[model samples]
Target chain A: MKPFSTMKLAVAFGTAALAALLTAPANAAIVLGGDNGWEVSYGGFINLFFTQSDFDSQVPACAGPTCSEDSTHMQEGLLPAFHTLTAKSPEIGGLKGTAQITFAPDSSGSKAQRLNKGGAMIDMREVFFNVSGDFGTISAGRTLALFQRQAILKDMTLFGVGALVGPDGGGTSLGRIGFGYVYPDFRTRFTYKTNDINGFNLEVGLFDPQETTGTAAEETDTPQFQTEMTYTTGFEGGSFNAWAGFLWQELEVQASTGGATGDIESFGWNVGVDVKMGGFNVVGSYYDGQALGTLLFPNVAQSYACDAFNCEEAENDGFYVQGTYTFNGKTKLGVSYGESNQDGTATGAPESDNSLWTVGVYHDINSWLKVVAEYDHQDSETLGNEADIFGVGGFILW
Target chain B: MFSKINIVRFLLALLVTASWSPLARADEDIWKSGLNLYVRLTEQDDAASGRPVPNQHPVNLDPAAIANSLIDIQVWDKHWFKKDEIEEVFSPEQARLLGQQLAIALRKASPGQDIVFAVSRTDTKFLGFRDLSYTAGRAFYSNDRLNIIIGDFMRPPDKFQERATSSAGVMEIKYYFRHGRRDDPSDFESAVMTGDGVEVYNEGGKRRLDWLVIDVNRASAARLAEEKAGEEANAPVSDEALRQEAARFAQERREMRLEMARMRKEVGSGQTGAESTAPIESRLKTLDELRQKKLISDEEYERKRQDILNDL
Candidate 1:
């Protein structure tokens, strides 16, 4: 199935998944089919961030009042409220069973101008099952893409802010996503993750191949291959986690003349490190790829390129580094700088380069509530524009 | 689009969560609740709103405020308390100041925790099944080591106090115990504590909230300041290691408790059996002498004296 249809199917499946999960009676374990070891629980957070942005003021205004025109309005932060349902089965024959369903209702304004006015549509993000024991864990289904998984999850801006102002505001803080690293869009796959040998973990998987734009035709039939190796250890003052990720996928785009662009290979690799000592934390991430867009682990044809009858591969590389200090336990102050540059592929082809410098402060009030404020200065070489955004938001995590 | 299947699914989910009650939960209550408030409405009110809580009474001048702190009942099992289950137990006015007051304290103690298991789960124990009363008051987990807060109280000092004999005001105690550490009867101290608690509120009087401030008597803290302190000198360890160390530390603690009990019973007799007037310095000197005589090793001497002084 095409990626777009598969996404729609995922949404369809997600709508019913949460009902069963959220409705499960509050019991220590939701044993089914006499599964004594089965345990189920639900957890999630609700976040809403209102923002105001002042672009270079060079771009012309829209002719009429349209939902997309308003940049100074209440918008959902990059990460919307998400619901997770988890079930774990006790060790049976030395192996345990794990299943999870994660869904985030669309709060972005893409469907409607007023927030929440666009009735929520379940965006099922993760639905997977796994069985594991001492050897390791092998999982199959839909979940986070292996590439750049650690970097993005460790991105503090994930819990803070990043990217465009609205319509959807930011769908799960892109945190330098399109600018520093390609968003590792979710994919269906079968994966194997080794149990930590010492403090090192290794994961390798086969993913469903995606069709990139500008290709003459769909040609490759093989699955995409990806792998990640991470090392985690703790010392006197703090701890550190570092990882490297790589992925390769073949692409084919069909031409209108019923011809094919034959075959093109896309490959990307990312490396990142996270370190913390006392009240301060530092994160650095860098990635380089061919045929990969500047930011996204790329979900669109726009990120890559297409020639007369073939897809043109481009060299892309970007890096993001952040430093943050925690105040007592309730508040944190942080600043980050990042840039993503995609080398031009053709004569006069747009050379896309994007960079962002940002500072943010977050305060956790009690256990359920949090308040955050951030300011971002974004420059896009491709668009030849710069935007400054200031935003403040609150979230209730249950 | 309100598809029939979607509607049916939503209904089923709502019913399931609605039917759940932690008190009537499965073998393992997934709710992970604090203090068991499972009692009659009248008993619940008395435990919650009653002045001079039965055994754990406050020494703070403002008893009402202490009452509020000990039992800030937000939401309880509706099935359990039907008659006295107030919809609005704490009015907005009462909780407003409490909200502001506890914000900084909670942040400091729990840090990133949105749900402080320590403060939220500690329950009021009025369960008088004498034989099962142990099961009623505190819900202690074996794995729980590093200071699982059991709320605050103004304890009555002197020999009557369950934990301490000093009047360092109403201090909160982090109950530390092992499954079966005692072999005899006279052991007094449960755990040798250190460091006073964090200062929650010490301003004048009316608006006072005592947070985690565990300063055991200053005199002992001063005298024992240089008793070859071992535990204090080590790096902060994991709660698991601490619990293990705490369990092994029980043996010497028994000796200290027995020795202190014997000394107080025989030598220190006052009109009222209150705190010992003897400077803890004297006790440390006695411990030093014991170590010199090979009665106790240096490690045992330091640990026991620390426990004895904390008990004092």
Candidate 2:
């Protein structure tokens, strides 16, 4: 419990710090190396927001004692602002390569973390490198997970508040994450991507696998494997880019009794699309598979129990769809909805059907300032409560 | 992590080699490679919308040096339109028509440039309603007019999703310069002050980026200028020197004007005795002709007229 709480606080503070930093005036870039060598620069942004939530009091019949959801507080936006250091090689034979490090910290308590006070915690989010040429670009690092990359990236609430995952704490909103699909946490891996093959291409990679509950990290000998095939076509008016991706990994769990000790397998797949036509943009994603936990993959629900010689697996699936339209280049209106659930197991209880719906508007006041307002409704059968959250905030990027 | 180490090692090694690249030359030519040390420094300034480099400032480069050491290397290109397919897009007829249209429009604003020949059109998805074409061709002032050979045909293959400039039908490209200097000394000074700098636009062709980039041409001549601003591309210039040059030019202009007045008076006085009486009258007539033809303003003609009378 302490570890979970600490991790949550870390994420909250890291995101808040990013938001606060965004509000700071643009500063001089940190440059390393010299005039004819490698050059590196550092930059990032910060976002802060305020929310007012009035959770519905209705509880399911089997609801437990913990059912509070209403809250009023300042919180970080859906995505944490991260500072990054990008280094590049001086040109040699017309080709160059780049390496980047994205470091972010979590805020202490206040969502605003005004003046960067409240003792924030640091989170090393990503480190990656790429060497590009006429052939293509190959990248290796502990960066964003490949599965459902475009869906979450293109979400209207990507930088806005939605789903109220942490209505009480300034943690973070699920933002259709738990409600529809699992979180694709950053993973250590390598990927190979092709150049635009007539506006279409493919990406494939292998990632470090996560160990299940009661199992050591070494228990899983094999790495997770994944691939994504994307098709993008440009029409007279706009363009459409769609992708299908799949991930598979094996996990080992030690027997609590004497049954679930053999190697277990987890596999999942996802499909998504992004369309930008005129001033309108639309995005949709759907995912399903076995042993894919509801909130985040390889989560507690994904753990299986064994009875001497028998083991039971968890089957899971979910999806989300969203649409947005830009008006006059300054204002954008958007809406999104999603739902996800896990099947009941023979040895454990079934996961609840979680659903979330969000509506928001964002306005770019200037190059540095963006203002947003959103309303979200969340329903959970397992948590046994429905919550509605209203939030408004501003984001600054420097 | 080892990958990162290898990248650092590679960068270090390349640094050793880059010191020899023409980018290090004292008089590097940006028209050849584009990436130069001076430009890199200016590109790093992100504090304001205004960049360090001034617009439409002529940067002088040694043609002999360029011919000897320049190597044309394209660091960036999506190759959306292949070389063979370019003609299909920027056809001769298209270039001519666009160039003629620009000639009609730019005659006053851009007095030296007559046409925009380097023709490129908007992509089907280029977020606008009209079919506007960009004049990526180079504009050179020649024979008292700006002459652009429209139809260079190898530049800016579409991609203007933001500023849609065409209305009704496709209007010719407008001529504009930084601060609207119009081929003046201040304009050249602006260009020289900042040197040549290029911004690394976040081009999205690379699959590994997971991001998007916005790019624009920073060169004064054309939108499809070299990718990076070359190192030491501009001659070492000081504000004091520029002031001196302006003063010298002013002095020269005054002497030339006075000399021209003397020549006109001599011509009016006639080479033979028969026309000597008609000199002043003829000179006045000539001054009025110059004014009526708009060759000189009222004040300039009056000044010349008084100078010719004084000569008598």
Candidate 3:
């Protein structure tokens, strides 16, 4: 019940929570160009999974004396079906521009009961435009925020399900949001990225401020700032990618309304590395911050625990390590484990921890199709609940 | 509410119908009888052993590669012709050099005949009950020319392993020399051009062609020119088709302009205070030049001018 309550709250605030994997090769997409130099491309994938989950007895839904501890459902995995359209403009006066729009639709409805047509939902997760020239690129509009972006992108669960919220949960299943890292939930921001120099690039953005639930600190005059730096290099048979990200923001607690009027400073930082050699890949990432929330950045609802007279910012940290081996350029086997811990500021509040283990097998039928089978075990220490889920699915990409 | 069987039947019907379509018939006719071209494998050399290998004939090339390369060649050369499904592949700079080497081989083969050259890949596929051959590369001959068709097939896997991994496939050169009727009436009666195949040697992962010799006379050249001219004059465009084309062009132009306007907005907004105004000035000059050239109307130019000025 506790895990479900937290998950429901996350679902309510996390709009189209999954981020598109940015590591797919550019040539994999379909591009249409004309003699006039402008080009448009279309790319995305649709995936569906049949999953059977076994929940903890204490977390089962009960009707009278009857209790149900297991459920089977056809649903989307960590990623919803995505359809993205990108348009690029010809270079004019040394400046080139691109605009992208992505739509994610759930494969199943939210209702616990089947065959509910009206329960399906579509989320416009990305609507952004960017301009680039010799200097760098400046992006505007809503997109995946920068904080902890690399961690999720590098997670093997990006291609397979790692965690399940519930049998009939809406949107996309949570891969490792609460288990290993906080969701970088897409946000509206204006960011500038420097041109790659010696395989290193820096990006900084000013995001629309976030609100803390029940903190009475909604009034914020300063935009939240986020920045990330990454370095990439390759050897004869291997490659490496290392990244670091930082986030900072301040919230003003209104005294006139209730509680003490003061500024609560929230900050977070993360570092991650990914290495690939021949057929093997390894990734490790860690994050530490205050008021950052265990599941979502800035912990919109629980960033700070407030009393009638004062408020204290909560502390959160998490890490995940994963490894995978690809065989003959087609099939991949992977395993990963991660944990996230939260220290609430409310007096005598118990520390909460969430962890997950995922083992998966993914096979590419061709360049545009893939099949996946996965098993996941998730544990919520504070709530004394656990779940085991098994799923099988396939994806069609264009 | 179609049943599953009905859906399957519908799909099968579509496939069968497509195989018998007019275009499909044309493709078959062209590859079989359109031109009297012949391709023969003359030599197979092993690069690793540095010896002329024997008894290796009819090498199978990747059908997909041949089809793709043929389509690319036809589009690039603006010449369309279908040949027997043979096989081959290459890049542009290498293609240019290969063309030159092919031209030299044609000169040596025919001595005095004008030579027209074309490169293409070959494809073979099976229809429901018949084997259909498709050739996708450029093929043309004109003005007393010796038409040389260089059909390369996929290198044998064993042979490929002998060369560097970066090596492109071996190119087999088959040259056709047309003899005049007056000089060789018996040869002209056969309707098939006679040619000699050159030995293709693989040296350091590159293909080398030996010289070829064949006989050519002048009379057969004019006949092929007339054939090419007839093929060059395609069907005339209908008035309705012209209207549709014009409308599509107009729509594309309108979209390009709208895209340009949006890009200008993005560029203007991204500018920082410390940045120089040189870029804005340069853009204005470019806009004026476009107007002077009548690329953009005066009214459109003025609107854009105001937008650029607003950026300042």
Query: Against the unseen true structure, what C-alpha lDDT does each candidate score?
Result: 0.51, 0.52, 0.56
Arrange candidates by lDDT, descending. Answer: 3, 2, 1
What's the count of clashing pairs in each model shown?
36, 26, 4
Q: Could you tell me how far off, in angstroms, the CA of residue B265 lies in candidate 2 after the best superposition?
A: 47
**Would you list the clashing residue pairs of candidate 3?**
B70-B136, B87-B152, B87-B153, B144-B221
Q: Write the per-residue lDDT of candidate 2 for residues A20-114, one digit (tens) a residue.
A: 53333223243576665778766566677788987654454435445554578877776665666777766555455667777765432444543
Q: Write the per-residue lDDT of candidate 1 for residues A1-398, one digit (tens) a residue.
A: 24545534653465345334323422445566465767776667777777777655223553333412336656566676667677777775667767777777745554343345344556777787776767777777788788887666666677666766232343445556766677776678777776645456677776777774435345445567777776665432356778888777766555523232444567777899988775688999999877676656545354445555545667778889999998764678999888888887662234678888989998876445678999888877644556777889887765
| Total clashes in model 2, counting residue pairs 3 or more apart in sequence or in different chains | 26
The RMSD of every model to the true structure, in order and in angstroms, is 22.6, 20.3, 27.6
Instruction: Give the DockQ (C-alpha) for candidate 2.
Output: 0.02
Q: How many backbone clashes does candidate 1 have?
A: 36
Q: Mind giving the per-residue lDDT tens digits that candidate 3 earns over A1-398?
A: 01335433553343223112111112223246656677887767788888888877334453443233677878887777777777877776667777778777777655565433345446777888777777777777777788888787678787687787665565578898889888987788777776645556677777888875544436665567777777665432467888888787767666423355566677887899988876799999999887777777766445565566776677889999999998865788999999999886763224778899999999876555679999999987543557899999988866
